[model samples]
Target: MRRILVTGARGQLGSQLLRCAEDKGLQAAGVGSAELDITDRDAVDRWVEPDAVVINCAAYTAVDGAESDEAAARAVNEIGARNLAAACSRAGAGLIQVSTDYVFAGDRAGDAAVPYEADDPTGPRSVYGRTKLAGERAVHAELPSAQIVRTAWVYTGTAGGSSGAGADFVATMLRLERERDTVRVVDDQMGAPTYSVDLAAGLLELACTGGRGVTTLHATNAGSATRFDLARAVFAEVGADPERVQPCSSAEFAKPAPRPAYSVLSPRSWEAAGLTPLRPWWEALADALARLG
Candidate 1:
């Protein structure tokens, strides 16, 4: 049996991983930033035991905030990753680094583009993206055998989830549904919504199976959707008027960081590795909503 250690334990993904670990029969330990800051090399060294499977869920995910706080982002996303890689290498432990779709330059550029494959060239357009890309490079440099799984637009049904209340698009829309008459969401940017519960299962599968032939993978729920599409789905799921969720362009809702217009990542490499792809985004969303209640 593989001994598992999950960093970012308080986060949505981490919490879900903990909840699912028992079912998967994984010998697991989870720690949050307060318990084990990944940026601290000594702490990481102490935490990463020999022959352990380390799942790094810790990251600086504030896309807009990262623009003004690149140093803070780099500390957690890049340096933290480097520290984990180094510790894992020294201890002979396997590292699974959780990443995001932001690593790609999501510009649609006129015509429709294919979803990004695991080996596709990365060109991040935001500070958060650049730092995460740097983290990926740092991990690969330190441990070539490390597994990287990039996901997008994650939500959770678990109350007091690590990502925070209303942090995800689904939760935000639900809140707005109760507070406002209408919610205007961006329709330009596109990607899949991945529920943390579902994502946690996939991560565990990789760790338990040694992540064979899956050096780097895109592990989001199947299907593509925009913010508007997601907001409407949230409303529909809650028995609210879907029309209350209106579509708007990205320019109308300006932010500090630029998001990729098309960030739908492909799971070809994951499938090629003989692993089952995650369920459809909409199906997972419904399950998540049911669990939330």
Candidate 2:
């Protein structure tokens, strides 16, 4: 059995990856930041094994915080990724660098909302986006064979989720439904609401193949929805009135980091690569809510 090594094992995706690996009876080891800091090239070198497939889920994912902490974000998003790629290159190991959809500027062409292709031109608008893009480039530069999987709007809908600060979007909605009479969610932004469990399964399947297919691909639950749509869906799932979730524009809820207005990734590349297509976002949301109950 090929050894599976997961960095950022405490995170939602990494934890799900570990669970999926165990369910499939794959040989897997997980390491959180305390166990192995990816930014330290020497430490990363000592951690990676030549016969293992390293799934790098470690990242500085504080979007708004990145606006003021570029150096910190860059250290993990770019330098850390470079370290892992270099280590993998030296060890002759396989790597799967997890990335975000922020690489795209999120602007649709006129009124048309086209899903972003894997090879689409990138134009990151915020510090977080730019740093993640840098990480992607670094990994490609160091290990051309490494797979870069870009996903969007990922959530587990579980209490005390990976955010560490508080509940994730879905989980938050679930809470607000019980605590508040109504909620307002931004409707302008659009992207796939991917469940972490589903994405982990897809990634594990890719790992089993040893990253032989496409080098870059987008893996998200099929179909797209705005934040408002997702919020309403969550409300409905829990027997709450979906109408209680009202729609608003992004301007109402300003943030430090600029979110992509339309960052839905196309499934063309993923499907073409012979990978199993993820279920639709609505379907995934239903399953996620069920798990929470």
Candidate 3:
């Protein structure tokens, strides 16, 4: 069995990947930024092994913060990815780079808001998005055969979710359901609410099977929803009244970095690559809540 080496091991996806790999009895190891700074080319070279398939989950994912810290974001998202790709190239190892749906402009509406295909033209509008797109380009440039998997709205049902915020959207909704009589959520933005555990499983399968003909693919829970829909679902799942959640517009809570209005990634490319399609977003959310309790 090929060894699995996960970067950003302490992260939601990385940690879940590690657990899944161990459960499957795969030879796997993980390294966080503290253990292996991917931005340091020499350190990455020293850390990467020839027989391992490296899953790069390390990233500067502070979307709002990236507006001011573009250099830091680029260091991790672009240069750091380049370093990993170069090391993998030299070591004759496989690389799977994690990406985001923020790479697209995502301004389409109504009938035009179809899911984004892997080969669609990119139009990133935020520093985080731009830097991540650069990382994708860098990875492809350094290692043409490396696989890039893009996902969106990823969350762990755990206490502290992946967003680096105090609590993730789901956790926050749970809190709000308890503290307030009503809650407001943005309904204009749409994307799949991907469960980190599900994504990790798919990635592990990809790591084990090696690349198909395609280099880039999209992975997320099957269905798409707006934040309002998701928050209401969370409330309903926890036996709270879904009607307590109200729909609002993005203008109500503006952030430094712009969020994609439509981020639903198409699974056509992923399924065409012979990978199993992820379950529906609602199903995944139910399972996530069950696991949380």
Give per-residue CA lDDT, model 2, range 207-237, as digits (tens).
8875446999999999999999999999988
Q: Alpha carbon lDDT of residue 167, candidate 3?
A: 65
Please give, for residues 13-118, the per-residue lDDT of candidate 3 as tens digits. Answer: 8888998898888889999988999999999999899978999999999899999999999999999999999999999999999999999999989789999999
Cα lDDT of model 2 overall? 0.92
Which scores higher on TM-score, 1 or 3?
3
All candidates' lDDT scores? 0.89, 0.92, 0.93
Clashing pairs in 1: 11-162, 106-260, 106-261
Give Cα distance to truth, residue 223, candidate 1, Å: 0.4
- Residue by residue across 1-293, what tens digits does model 1's lDDT show? 87999998888888779889988777999999999999999988989999999999999988999999999999999999999999999999999999999999987555657789999889999999999999999999999999889999888743345556336667777778999999899999899999988899999998988767468999999999988999899999989999998999999989999988999999897887777799999999999898778
Clashes of 1: 3
| Candidate 1 lDDT score relative to the true structure | 0.89
List runs of model 3 lying over 4 Å from the truth.
Answer: 162-166
Worst 10 residues of 2 by lDDT: 158-167
